[model samples]
Target: MRLSMRARWALMFGGLFLLAGTALLLINYVLVNEIVPQAGLFVSNFAGGPGVSGGATVTAPPPVLDKQFFQKGVEGAVDTFRASAMQKLLIASGIALVVTGVLAALLGWWTAGRALRPLNTITSTAQRLGAESLDRRINLDGPQDELKELADTFDGMLDRLAAAFDGQRRFVANASHELRTPLAVQRTLIEVAMADPTATPELLRLGQHLLHTNERSERLIEGLLVLARSDQGLVSRVPVRLDEIVDAVLRSSAAMATEQGVTLASDLEPRVVMGDSVLLERLVTNLVHNAINYNEDGGSVLIRVGDRPALLVSNTGPEVPASAVPALFEPFRRLNRERTASRDGAGLGLSIVRSVTHAHHGIVYANPNHGGGLWIAVDLPLLERTMTSLSPRPGADPAISRG
Candidate 1:
């Protein structure tokens, strides 16, 4: 099993303590029973009266060597001492182990924290960092250890990422501007040709087709530019009334809905959010347009604004496949059958909505309606009430009404 660093350190310290204590206990056992007794006998023999040697007259009689008595006496005393010493050794070893184990645990915890401090910093930095905050760095200051090396590598990677994103934003912005000039020239030339007094019927038909094609190209470029700008993140925020944006979108799309034979319905409540007004308007417009374009004839679109979520757009249309719903937010992705039926869209409507919502730190959800159609809702952060002016309260009308 894999163990965390803290656990590993605790085990290591505990094991070392156990091993060292065992070794000391065994050494004490040997010294008390064997070495001390032998040393005492040698000392006693030297302290006794002198013994007769080499036929010389002995000044004092040598002590009798009573083998059995001496053996019994020494053996009895040694046994008593051995038992007492063994008991003391056991008690001391037990006390030492208990004390050392607790000390080892505390020491291990402190050491582990010291060793993993760098990793904690790295984790916090990564969590706080994103595409918008890539400039923040973990300039770790310490010895040139392994952790320091890892921190350095992470900072270098962030540097590369920030540079790459900057390059992409510049390219998109420049390319969009560059392409607009030629497109404008082409449009002017086509208009001049069509306005000519000598224009033929066949030439007029061709000019109309070219004009439509150029307009589609212009919309595609505009969508790309919006996507790029949204990816750069919002730099400023202001309180924008979501209901006002919804009413504006409804006004603009009323003609399109009428021409397409689709009924429009809405129940918008006054809800204020913090975001860019232009982007929020675009977000609402794209969603309303998509609901109308993909809808069936005589179908209905329902828009709702609430204090909680801010905005929701749902439409009645051909049955949408559950699996294909997620791909609706991807750029240039469209259902082949749906695109073939509706020639006006460039498949960037929902994608732009998603990007703009994300830039404002909001969330968008899409769900396929049971029988047919799609339901999309946007949840945006609300502006604080302190900054909002008070208005007369209206009764809660969560019900959708069609006009």
Candidate 2:
């Protein structure tokens, strides 16, 4: 089993105590063994030993001198006493050592838990955080130690991130508002030019082409703005009927699908998601539009809305590689040379879908179709957490930015 840092630290503490205790016990045993023998413990004395000759009485070197000896029974008794004493010492000390070691282990566990509590706070905060919640801070309070420093550093990083997001939101807002006015003026001029009765056929055709290009730019800009808005965050939470939105997208996409010889089909259940209504509509529209536009002639586009995933859009067209699936959602990142040649798309369809999903705190992914094309799945929650109210954009829908 994989051990957590706290567990490993606790075990180390317990092991160290056991090691020291065993060493101390060994030293005590050795000391008692050596000192008891020298202390004359259980010594006994006797008067005589066998004479050197067969019948000679026991004698000393001189008349006044005497000799002492230990009987075999006396030596045996001393050995037995020492052995019993050593055994008792070991038993008593062993029990104490075990008890203390257990206590040491419990103390170590508690100490480790306290020391690592800050890390748990950091982990939980990181897990709960997202782009939308970058404003959150750890603000961990304690002594000015390593953990506190880490928390302060983390808070600083969040501060910088929140500022950056705010700046990007501001830039997108200003650019969208400023740029839309001129484009609107150009569109007016183009329309007025095309309405002239005196205009020649070639002039009319040129005007029409210019008008088409201008509209394409407008859409590209609009898609970009929407992308920024979604990236900034989800605006609000209202009960949005997802199936109804898909139906509306399908109706609007009917002409494009017909022009491309593609069939638009749907199997939508009554699924209501908690998200911005405009964002939800844009997400569905982008998917349906991309599906129809990217498919082959006489191919089919299917939109399925259900409880689990919320939305699924699949089409039959070009064969996309497995390795290229990740790039599909990236802004302006398209597969194949033909993708750049598409006239209607600003190449922000899937990108917009991604941003919208992120704003709603949902999951979006895609896989290459078995035969051809791609299948995209958007998984959104039917309910959402508390959301903040966002200020409305002056003259357009929720706009997006490039960052």
* Best TM-score among the predictions, by candidate number: 2
Give the local distance difference test score of model 1.
0.81
TM-score of each: 0.73, 0.80
Colliding pairs, model 1: none
lDDT of 2 by residue, 1-403 (tens): 9999988988899899999999999999998877665223333212333343222243423335432333444557667877899999999999999999889988999999999999999999999777667877898989999999999999999899889988887899899999899999998998898899998899899998888888888888899899988988853578877877887878787888889999877776667778799989999988888888788999988888776798988889999999998988888877874555537477888899998998888999999888899999999876543222322222322222211
Lowest lDDT 10-residue stretch of candidate 1: 52-61
Instruction: List ranges where model 2 is wrong by over 4 Å.
Output: 37-80, 235-239, 338-342, 381-403
Error of 2 at 177 (Å): 0.9
